[model samples]
Target: MAERDGGLLLFLTGAGISAESGIPTFRGPEGYWRVGSVNYRPQELATFQAFSRMPDVVWGWYLYRRGVCRHASPNAAHLAIVRAEERLGDRFHLVTQNVDGLHLRAGSSLARTYAIHGMIDFFRCARECTAETYPIPDALPLDWAKDRLPTPEERARLRCPRCGADGRPHVLFFDEYYDEPRFHCESAQRKALEASALVVVGTTGLTNLPMRIGAIAAQRRIPVHVVDLEPNPFVEFAEVTGGEFLRGPAGSLVPELVERLVG
Candidate 1:
């Protein structure tokens, strides 16, 4: 219900935004993690079955990823989103596919920022006894390259405080279905439905939710500006929605777009 010129603005981001901060994309070659002699792709390691089979292995992978994210700082693209939020205030809503938490770190409010992929810095009880998500301590090592499997001591430390059950990373695994309470899927859908303008940054629309967002905007005759390093499937959708496709790195293009739009 928040209005900007005549409509709301919804900004959707993906791994491309965080990649500017030197964070690797999940489907990229860098996303492959080796455990012992077996190499697991992100899709394989990031699943409920993987966690059920080897909780330590899964937790270790997440811990390593968390370390990487913690080491990387928010880039200009993230800061631009914060500025856009400031200008648009209640009219701006962010729906991000990245779990790196860069958007929140860049000062976007949690109330307006929907992390549809959940967050890497949070942990929940594996049993889902409660909906509580506890923040992981900052004191944990940021360099976990040596050990891909958590030590017995580390496993004990990762146990859920309330239920004495194993703690799992608060991320939407590949096999997990999206839900409102956990992943803000419903909220994102509602925002897209009501959005006056949709600004897509660093995403290729590979996932269902993002594609649906584009389709909704196109159907509603809302402008859908897309920014990415290379041409993507979204460019066609942008043209269909009467928006331009700005081909460039998000770090450079997003700030320029924000300045032009908000200035």
Candidate 2:
């Protein structure tokens, strides 16, 4: 699967890919971070209502995730994708489920990269209210410790600067709908549909309307490969499962894939 290049290599990734960096998957080691059970479901922490009604809780979750992502370095798998992108050039699209800007931070210049989950580094005007909101690219509050404790000021201003509604993490909640242009962003997917090769990594394959996109590639008989820890529903759309669907983590498997493509 890695050997094929010079065509579209759409790399779709998920939270599992980031787990190698010691960052917790929404359901971390003990499972959920909430009380009672360690297995925590994102629920309120990642919802439109939570973002709108409970900005503090939602943003607090973002704060915790932000801190983790800020300090977390991209793993070998991420770098491998970058290398593969360099090898494939414009032929590759690294679409990710994660909102964290890790791939961008990893020096991935591949412009086709898409963030289905939105971004944490940049905040928007809550409800698309204004054209501009404060873009905090590099850092966070000066006093993260106090901020974590839910200081009063932090709670008040967390409101969205865009709509004057409450501000929440820029991440896409399950109920939220993407404006199409920003989420899918461009004609990249259409181009990839016409691609000679397609690649999916680490995703659970439960995202948006894939039936149409999947059919596009199937109609063309484009070679598709799936890589993950377990069998993904998208695997059926693939011609082959080149890497373990549920075995090696992305950090371990991605480099091998890069080397294959680059070879």
Error of 1 at 15 (Å): 1.1
The segments of candidate 2 whose C-alpha lies over 4 angstroms from its true place after superposition are 1-5, 28-41, 130-134, 137-139, 142-152, 155-166, 185-188, 209-215, 240-247
lDDT, candidate 2, 1-263, per-residue tens = 43453466666677767777766666433223342233235764577765666565556567666776777898888888888777777766777777767788887773667776677765666666753435443445633431243456665666565456645566677787754555663454576565766656666757663334455566677766667778767666774423223345777777876676565
Top candidate when judged by TM-score against the true structure: 1
Candidate 2: Cα lDDT at 12 = 67
lDDT of each: 0.86, 0.63
TM-score of 2: 0.79
TM-score of 1: 0.94
Q: Which structure among the candidates has the greatest lDDT?
A: 1
Per-residue lDDT of model 1, residues 1-263, tens digit only: 22436568899999888988999886767778788888888889899999999888888889998888988999999999899899888888999999998899999999998888889999989999886888876556778783377788887777789989988999999899888878888889999888888899998888899888888888887888999988887788789878989998988999998887764
